[model samples]
Target chain A: MSIHTLEVLVENEPGVLARVSGLFARRAYNIDTLVVGPTSNPEVSKMVIQVNLEGHSLEQVIAQLDKLISVISIEELVEGAKKPVKDTQPDYQN
Target chain B: MATTHVPTANGTVMNGATSLVKSLEAAHVDVMFGLPGGAILPAYDPIFDSTIRHILVRHEQGAGHAATGYAQVTGRAGVCIATSGPGATNLVTPLMDAGMDSVPLVAITGQVPSAAIGTDAFQEADIRGITMPFTKHNFLVTKADDIPRAIAEAFHIATSGRPGPVLVDIAKDALQTQTTFNWPAKIELAGYNPKIVPDNQSISDAAALIAQSKKPVFYVGGGVIKANAHKELAQLVELLGAPVVTTLMARGAFPDSHPLHLGMPGMHGTVAAVTALQKADLLITLGARFDDRVTGKLSTFAVNAKVIHADIDPAEINKNKFADVPVIGDLRETITALIPALKSALAKNSQDLAPWNASMQKLKSTYPLGYTLPDDGSLSPQAVIERIGKISGTETIFTAGVGQHQMWASQFISYEHPRTWLNSGGAGTMGYGVPAAMGAKVGAPDSTVWAIDGDGCFQMTNQELVTCALNNIPIKVAIINNESLGMVRQWQTLFYEGRYSNTSLESKRVPNFPMLAEAMGCVGLSCERPEDLDATIEKAMSINDQPVVVDFRVHRDAMVWPMVAAGTSNDEIMIARATAPDWDSQEL
Candidate 1:
């Protein structure tokens, strides 16, 4: 099993993060690295969620991510894209 | 000539009040319950016109508890707002309640202006520092620019991992600041990320043990309820064919009607559940931390069983009992993973429950939650609880404080649905019932709410009674008045050689609760004997204009049945001595 990094673009609003985090939380997704920052567009922000998965669990994560209404775009940043950056190391769990 | 850079006093670029609303809206705070005050006037001014519904609470504590109730019921962070000094201090009770119960809540307060912060200015208090230990995290935002981040941080700290309450303080000047506000809906907290899955090997090992064990039991906790994994828990338990013993918080996670459900297992647990745990070969604990009340003198707890503990919080994993297998992950994920693994393991082997099932049934008939309800006059706490339960029925929401009353309520009440019964389980805060009941009412405004409490426990925060009256929150307060600290007395009689010192409140100068209720502008009823109990409670519960408090003068020495005496194993619970009825069993 390896950790996968996912970049998610979402609408900027209150509870958007809670909904996303709660989705991962309720589904039992082990979030490792989550980075959210305002993009050039004021009404949208990019969230990078890193989670470890066994086998095909990453597919489930991607599918779940698409279900959130606030999520505009999601791309897996593991293996090929950005090739496993050390800075993406998992930080502390809140 | 005056170039002191005062930032234009009140009309500066940052209006701390508006910023708070924008930040709260950014945090997706749907509603906020609070009472307006002089110190928090700036914040209220904007809230009056904001999209976020602001409820005017009777007391600051009520606001806090309402948020707690909302959070507990909805599994989202409940939000409340209050002013400085007295208002902030009042929010403490509910904040502490939420913290103790592991409910996610966000409490925002308006502090005195920065210039008047520590001078005890008419409504000035250091709420941030005072609430530090009791909260998951707290922040005192001095700069107006930090208002959004502070609120965002509070919400993050409150709802993430090991959920609890968080407090944010905004100075009056900060609320009045006028600044460029772009509410960022999402946040990236650097120091906060809760683990949601266990190491694969630990999960494999736990699954293996469950497969090999002949007799196994699953101990569930509030974590299962909070994680919304009740169905998953049931699935796993069914897969393993194990009996479940729930902590106070975990009630309703496993249907009590299930053949394998053993009800609550702890200081006041059932004999069947406790005995099942004692005789098990392996204990698969999910979302439950080993609380002392559940595992008396840890050394003797489940001596025959090896523990496979799974919890979301890492600190709780090996804190109490050593685990043969420790799984740190969200309960839903852990259970989801265990189900498939256990199914695979069980496919290779088979076991029968005939022997284990027979033993549990024997314990149930031996020491059921039984008590004789007298037809005559002397009041029994059990009878009082039974009557209340009968009236509330299965659909009503019941909340209790920590005391003999709480135990009695847990015993007598039949909770059919999950989250219907709320209480301060682990923290054991005495004055929690009323506030919590009030909170539950706010959560389900149309549902019947009953706050059951003991005389000793009620007085701890009886002040909230006023909050109920002022808010017209019609919750029935059932006071099991033995006129003494019943739990302590029972402990003294059972363990400490019967040295009932300082247990009796007979001589202590306490206010007349009924009269106090009247003074607080609520209806009060007192029942000195069993004959008046039924009608009195019915009348009290019927009141719709204001809250009602009923003091039921119960038997002083009455103890909650099936109690596991301290330092003793759960198997050795003391049943409600079925022999004596105290002679006054029927009369006043």
Candidate 2:
């Protein structure tokens, strides 16, 4: 299994978030982390979803998500680029 | 802020409920199935003024299934309405069933007032949240002005692409408030554009594969019927001159009497059909999703075949199995394009597939569908279904609740046209027969609709018979009463060492179906003797003004033959239990 991040842009409408999350839930796909916020366009909302799944299952989940009527676009995030990093303490020895 | 309210051109200010009804009328929704309640009273108030005819169902579940039945018959989005809380929850089963089967339906429910939402007010429920997982899309209308657009979008989403149920939960206050209603000329759903035209390259590739293959099998599914591509599919099948196997949901998609038709393929499918699919080299799956039931032990199923999966839904293409060439678009359009492509590509080659055809024909004749009649005088379920098929002929729309009866109907009936058979294929929801039959009769008023139900399934949703009687829907219901959950009992008998656990229904305590039908204003008849079968069916067929119910008490131990037990490969199919033979080993 691999961890993949999908960035989805959807129409900013009521229940759009539910539609996205509900898609994952219905398929029984686990979501590691999900973050939603306003996009640059006021009419659209951006959702960053991280899921741990096999390649085939991830492809299916993405395809299913794309079929949603409210979903505008979807992009998978690369491993090293713009990853969310946790805060680290200063090393005393260094 | 000062604002002036402008009335519509007709000088009529419409409320949310009125606007919703008007939008349905604009969509040409002539019939609806629903039950009214407190929050949805406003919607019902305008029904009298609208041209839409509403059937008051006995229960919300019945209404939803009725809508699914209507959608399956008309190829349009069937509309249903319900009130808040329990009423909305009651629609969950049918919505999920519709979602699984890809039936087009639009369900509108009244929610608690906007101010009362989330307050746990009386009759308050988050219906949008509840139906989110199953519905294609759902809307929660907080404002009165959004009614028209929401209704239009719901209809569009429900009927387009991979069709399924869409829910619109309108707040009670929205229904009560007034607004200037203007029907939108076109829907503006930016993300919902379905690709109706197939990619030409993919079509040509599929056509080339079809033309070159020596042993090809066309695996069709409900999508063929859903897309109304029967004509195109039949043309392609005839062009390829290959055997065709229609899945359970696709029983009527292809004519059963066709020369190349190899009955259904699944757990209860014909041996020849299953054997052909398992051994075929090229599998051209048209709109079939390769469900687990159809693919027993998927790793070994069609291992020798290179699949050409053509489906309207792109998600279903590679969901279960890898597709060598995927044609993603509407089935009708894809098949229409592929037909000519195959004709041009296969014009020169006259590759004869005599040996394969001969082998299939041999298999078909060798182990034909058979069941033994009991010497005791009790009726066999298969015989009953076969007799019904013979009497009903090709024009009747036969529906079934899931069981041995459903398999028998699928095996025995000859469906000459599309949309003549409706059932819950994916969900296998019991109690679907009666309401679905009612909806089918309503959708095709001139056609004879039959609901062949098992006794176990009939008790689940038989209350819809009251709705049928009151609505003057003349549907025929034949209950195969085995006094047990026949399918489950058979499994238990085979796999569970003859231990029948809670499968037997206490028919003695339960009201007799014939008497119950009589109480519900339907003509009821009970047939027990095998000789009475033909006469009973003829008597039931004679009734045209009111609904009729015939209870046939079949033998409880009679099991469906040619069984391929779950998880077993198709090669392991058992015609029947082997018995000891008289020995003459000395001569051998």
Candidate 3:
């Protein structure tokens, strides 16, 4: 098993967070770490989800998440990019 | 001069309730099923003068299942409405049921005012949160302005590729506020794009596999029915002259009378079908996921088979069994493309399937589906179902509750057309037959619809008889009354040493099914002797003004045979309690 991170952009609305997180649980996909924050356009939210899976499961999860109405686009970040300097991670000051 | 006809959806300024009604009208909604309560009261105000006919159901669950039934048969988005909290929560079962079976349904529920959402207000429940995992998509409309768009999107998402349930929960305040209604030019779903065309390479690869393999089986599922692709599927099946095994959800996808049809596969499936899958070398699976029930002991399931899986949903292709040649596209399109490709591939290499056909014929002749009469002399439930289907003929639509009756209905009924056989397959929910049958009758007013239910399943939603009686649905219900939870009791007899515990519902006359039917304003008839069975069913068929119920008190000892015990390999299938069919392949 290896680590993979999916950057999903979704509409900022009621139950948007629940829709994304609940999808993972429903499909029985386990998440190692998840971080959500507002984009420059306050109307859109970005969620970074990291999961440990092997074979085509990561591809399957992305395909499933893409079916949701709230989701706009999904991008897979490079594997090693996950461990940026500890302080360079997204800050929740706002 | 030519006129460009863009459908006009502009509407005058109105409250969200009227907006909701007008939006549904703009969507060309013919009928809806629902119940009204506190938070949903405003949405009901505009129904008095609306063109949409709303069937007032007895319960919210009934409304949900009724909508599901309507969607399954009609291939349209079924609409159901309910209030907040208890009403919304009650819809949980049918939502998940429709999700599993891939029915297109739109559920509209009212929520407490926006201000009271998280304050634990009376009649407040987070229904969107509860149903997210099951429904295909959902919307929580916090503003009245969002009503039209949300409703339009809900219908679009529900009926599109890989159709499933979608929910829209609007706040009461939103329904009371004023807004202008206008349908969007196009749905604004960015991430939702379903690929319909198959890649040429994939199609050619699948076609070559089919041409080269000696033993091939088309494992069809409900998607064939949903996509309206049975014609293409039948073409492919006949071209190869190979065996076909339709899953329970796909009973009518292929003609049951076809020369090469081997009935349904999985637990309680026919011996011929189970054996075809076990010994096959190529499985040309279409629109079917390798479900656990269908794949008894997956490791041993089709040990020699290589799957050529095709589905609209990519996630399903390799979720359970690995697909050697995965064709990710709509089944209708995929099959259409593969037909020509197969013809070309066969020009180069044509493998003879005579050896495989010999094996299938041996299994079919040796282990035909038949049940001996129970010692108690009560009517055999299987015989009762066959008689019901035989009398009703191929034109009629049949629905069943889950249990022995469901299995019997699948096995005995001669389904000739798509959508003729409707039942809860993936999610085996009891109490689904009556309401779904009622919905089917409403959708097809001229067609005869029958709900073959078991004694255990009938009592759960039998109250819906009042809905049918009050309306002019005129549905026929055949209660396979065994006076016990027949399926469970059968398992207890086999696995639990015949120690029947809490299995018997006790006192056949306690509820008095006939009396209950009469009280519900239906013609209640009971038949105990097999001699009177035909006449009683014929008598029930004669009535065309009101719903009729015939309680066939069957032998309690009857069990579904040609069985594969839970988690056991298909090789261990039992034709009877202790009898196993010896296959010709066993000698090979």
Candidate 4:
């Protein structure tokens, strides 16, 4: 099984973390490392979850993660690749 | 700069409880099943003035199952309410059942004040934490102003995509506090959109596979019913002329009386359906997860088939088995797209599948569903169910409690329309039949609803019959009184040297079911002899003013046949214990 790192952007709401972790536990998939923190926007939280799964199973896990109501966006981070810098400013001003 | 004092246009303020009621009204929720308690008293205070109808259930579990039944029949998200601690804890079973079956339901619970939330206060429990694993989503609302938005989002999430239960926990303080009332609050959830459109490539791939295969089978499930795609599914089935096998959750998705229908396929499924799946080369699964019950000994199940799995939930596509073509979208949309593509592909080839169709028809007649009449003059549960199927025809909806009787009803009864069958297929909850029947009656109102229950199962939650009686809902209940846990006893006899441990419920020790029904203001009847069953069933059907209960004392030794023992290959199915060659020496 290959280990993959996924970065997920989610709404800052109660039980959102439990929901993300619960999805993995229900499928009996193991999470190697999980880190959660606030994003540049106070309303959003970012989670970096690392898990070991086969190529096909990992695709299913990612699709399920994308299906969560609290999750905003998900991106797969390449191993040993540099993390992207956070952008603090909005692209368009109201 | 934003001002702190925001005044309402009408210069009126209401408590969170009133806002909650108004929010429910805005969401078009008219009925709710619940039991109130200490933490939830504030919410119930507003119910007196609201238009929402509340049916006070005997237990919290009944409320949950009733909500599920209502949701399944109405095609809308059902609403259920309960208080904190034990009340919220009791709803766990129904929530899990809805999650597994993908029924749309919303559960509202009252919580302790925000201060007492973590202090182990009286009648306080972390319901949001408890239901997080099973629910589609959950909310813990501590502010009065968040009431309307939370309620709206709860309904939206519960009814959207692959629908399941969602929970919203309201702190008591929030309900007591006054805030400006909002009738139509904006839903601010940004991450909860469900995909409805199917990928063009996947649909084309599935169409091509269907057009080319000679031995193709359409395996359908509850998703079709949930999506209300039965018409589209029927169109596809007719277009291809492929034999269809509906799973337990999909009993009514395809009309059982149709010529190409092969019935249910599982552990207790018919031999024709099971054998056909084993021989099929192309299996088109619509909204059906490859559940263990349907696929015995997974490695050897559908061994010759290449699967094309389509479902709204992406997670279900490859969770249990590999899918050569995985189409993720609504069943209605996916089927609608694949139909034209398949028609065009068939026009070019026009391959003959008559040989396969003839073979399946031969199998159907060779091993038709059958049971022998006992000469001892006792009622057979199978015969009872078959008689009910004949009398009810296609008009009545049948809900069953899990066991041998459940399997018998599935085999004997023919469902002609969608949402005509409701059972705890995934959770296998014993007491699901009574409350579900009550909920189905409430939802349909015009249709006849029957609860086919077992003696052991009837004892679990028969108190719901009181709810039916009090509410003036006329649901008929048929309890197949076998005097023992027949399914477990059959297993013990077959696998455990007939130990019969704790499975027997002697009639002497148990309360008389007919008497209990009469005491609860219902028309109660009982049948002991085989000749009395027809008359008793007719009598029960005649009483349409109130709930009726008929207890049929069936033979304890009668077992469900065409059984594939757990964890064994489907090919090793036992047609009948007496008929098997070398039955005395062969290991099960």
Q: Please report the candidate that would top TM-score against the real structure.
A: 3
Top candidate when judged by lDDT against the true structure: 3
The model with the greatest DockQ is: 4
Among all windows of 10 consecutive residues in model 1 chain B, the one with the lowest summed lDDT is B1-10
Sort by TM-score, top down from the best:
3, 4, 2, 1
RMSD values, in order shown? 11.0, 6.7, 4.5, 5.1
Better by TM-score, candidate 4 or 3 = 3
lDDT of 2 at B458: 92
Chain A TM per prediction: 0.80, 0.83, 0.81, 0.82
Candidate 1, superposed: residue stretches over 4 Å from native: A1-94, B1-14, B35-39, B51-59, B85-90, B115-125, B197-201, B372-377, B470-472, B495-500, B506-521, B531-546, B576-588
User: Which model is ahead, 3 or 4, in terms of DockQ?
Assistant: 4
**Residue B324 accuracy (lDDT) in model 4:** 85
Per-residue alpha-carbon lDDT of candidate 3 for residues B283-305, written as tens digits (9 for 90 to 100): 99999999999999999999899
Clashing pairs in 4: none
Considering summed lDDT, which 10 consecutive residues are worst modelled in model 1 chain A?
A: A85-94
Worst 10 residues of 2 chain B by lDDT: B579-588
lDDT of 1 at B347: 85
Q: For residues B450-563, write the lDDT of model 1, one tens digit per residue.
A: 889888877776676776676667888888888888888888887788899998986123667788778877788888777887888788767877888888888777777777
